[model samples]
Target: MRADSFFGKLTRTLTGDPGPTAPQSGGTRPKDLRRARLNDAVLAGESLVGALLTDAGMARANLSGADLTGADLSRARLPGANLARTTLVGARLVGADLKGAVLADAELTGAKLTGALLTNANLSDAELTDADLTEANLAGANLTSALLGRADLSGADLSDAYLTDGHLPNAKLRGVDLAGVNLTEAALVDADLTGASLTEANLGGADLTRADLSGADLTGAAVFEVRWTAGTRWPDREVEERLRALSQEVEPGVWTVVGDTGRSRGLRLGD
Candidate 1:
């Protein structure tokens, strides 16, 4: 049944059997769709730049506004994939599963995504500048308003991450490592963690106001209800007796954004 088959013309244009939503991609499919399954494939606004698609499954695929620049998509499964506004510049996505992937406003500059699972991933307003994400899990991920400049995110888990209104300053984590990161409720306002190591990190309710944690290595860090101030740079030793029963000194260097914190902290960034 070779009726112009590129997976039968994208499975008859995503199973309406009328075809041509935007399906005339260059040379018509088969860009080595390795281990291809393509469940629920729509391939919206398709371009698929530099496609290899190793281990492709593409679960719940819509591929909204797809470009996929420099795409490899290594180990691609793409669970619940929509890929809103997708470009994926310099994409590799090594060990990619992309659990609940939407990738809102995605660009993904210099993307690698070393061990990508991206649990509960949306990455709102995503850019991911110089992205590597070394040990990526991104547990309960939203990372609202994510830019992530020079992002390496060493040993990344990011447990309980919704990360609202993060205007992390100082060139956005220069020489970023983020050692042993959990960054719970991460919104390290004006973040500039000089010499960032952050060992054994949890950082519950993180909102490090004017944060600069110089020579940063909060040994066994928990920092419960952290909402720091006094231009926060608590260099070690003022873990402050583990933040003196939970650090709180808000309303200094004023940075506020109370806009629908994913329905007042019920944060759901993916489907």
Candidate 2:
């Protein structure tokens, strides 16, 4: 049987459409029935992507491993839905409610997620390269090891998100909030972090070579073991001096004896 014909029949049956034409295999279902049902609903324009309903008000529907490439799912409510390993490439998910959704290993490249609420969503190992996440609320989302290369995250709120070992090369993060977020071992080469807040953020072992940090707040941020250059801004001269002094303060009197020996060290300031 043809794939489109099978899909059309399955969609009609799931949506209760009277024109549903049964196929030879008795409208054989996909491997994941719940995901196939959701995909069918999307194809029939009955439910949006990530929506938590089957036209019967079923809560917490599972759509794991569904292929929803290029689907329009604007303003859908999908809280606590299991979308693990789903393919949402180029899908329109503007303002979708995806709080607490498990999107691990999902492919959402080039998707539109503007103003979407993804709080506490598990996006670990997901591929979001080139996705438009402008103004999306990703607070507390676990994005560990996700690939977000070249993603446009302007004005996005990523506060407290766990991005350990994530690849974010060339990502646009202008005006994004990353306070208390852990970016350990993350790759941010050539990424723009202008005006972003890094307060108390842990960037241990992260490579930020050539990345822009202009006007970014790194106050109390833990940057131990991170590789950065003089191009990385330090807020003000006082803050830079403080950090330099702290580095030297670990060994007291180390710089004091640099100018003279033991006899000169005992001499007074005016003597």
Candidate 3:
């Protein structure tokens, strides 16, 4: 973790501590800084722990509140980077591009970010506990109130993502596509999300308690006041017997999906 090079453009006379200076982690050893260009680098709150910065270009870099714990930043481009509240615990950032990156409240515990692009990234309230983000794209990402416990995010895309009030307990999210995601009240406790797609997803007031939505998908997903107890595992038994025989429970853990269901029922179940 001792690679560094100026190459140029960290500026304020190439980071001799003028434009922004916070990196004082003992007798610094940085050398090599693979592919270092450091475009727009400000290096805010810089510590850059375990820094190597592989392929660093750092486009629009601010590095806000930066610690960059265990940093490698593999394939780094860092498009529009600010990295707000950045710590990046156990960071590697495998294919980092971070398009439109802000990373609001980011800590990114155990971060790897396998195929990170993070399109339109903001990552509101981001923590991403045990993060891996296997096939990450995060289309239109915001992830409001994001914590993402035990995060894996397998094959992630998260189309039209906002993910309101996101928590995502025990998250793996296998085969994640997340079509039309807004997730107005996302919690997703005990999540594995086998074969996840989440078509037309809104899931207003979503809880999904004891969640295991087998063969997951919930087409035309509004699922108003969605709570789901009795160990929820739909997408079987004729779509939970046609959502308990033609979905209607105006109160008490309301899960309504009345119309526009059949197109082979583009389901949006979970785990």
- Model number with the top TM-score: 2
> Whole-model Cα lDDT per candidate?
0.67, 0.71, 0.77
* Stretch of 10 with least lDDT, candidate 2: 250-259
Who is ahead in lDDT, 2 or 3? 3
Q: Residue-wise lDDT of candidate 1 within 1-271, one digit each (tens)? A: 2323544455444454664556466636445556667878887767777777888888889988888898898889988889988988988989899988899878888799888999888888788876887778877787777777557665666556655553334334533444445566676666666666665556656777777777766665555456666667766654533453333344554332222434423221111
Q: For residue 191, what is the lDDT in candidate 3?
A: 82
**Residue 52 in candidate 2, Cα distance off native in Å:** 14
Q: In model 1, which residue pairs have backbone atoms overlapping below 3 Å?
A: none
Candidate 2 C-alpha lDDT tens digits along 1-271: 4444545555557666555245446663332123233421323222233332212321255757767777666666777777777888888778878898888998999999999889999999999999999999999999999999999999999999999999999999998999999998899888899889988887766777667887888776765545554454545676555444333222332211111344332221112
Every candidate's CA RMSD = 14.7, 9.5, 12.4
- Model 3 per-residue lDDT tens digits across residues 92-126: 99898998889999898989989989998998998
State the displacement of the C-alpha of residue 226, model 2, in Å, after optimal TM-score superposition: 0.9
Runs of candidate 2 with Cα error greater than 4 angstroms are 1-15, 20-59, 230-271
Superposed model 1: Cα runs more than 4 Å off? 1-6, 10-32, 35-53, 56-84, 87-104, 107-114, 117-124, 127-134, 137-144, 147-154, 157-176, 179-206, 209-226, 229-237, 241-271
Which 10 residues in a row give candidate 3 its minimum summed lDDT? 1-10
lDDT of 1 at 110: 79
Candidate of highest lDDT: 3
Estimate the lDDT of model 2. Answer: 0.71
Clashes of 2: 0
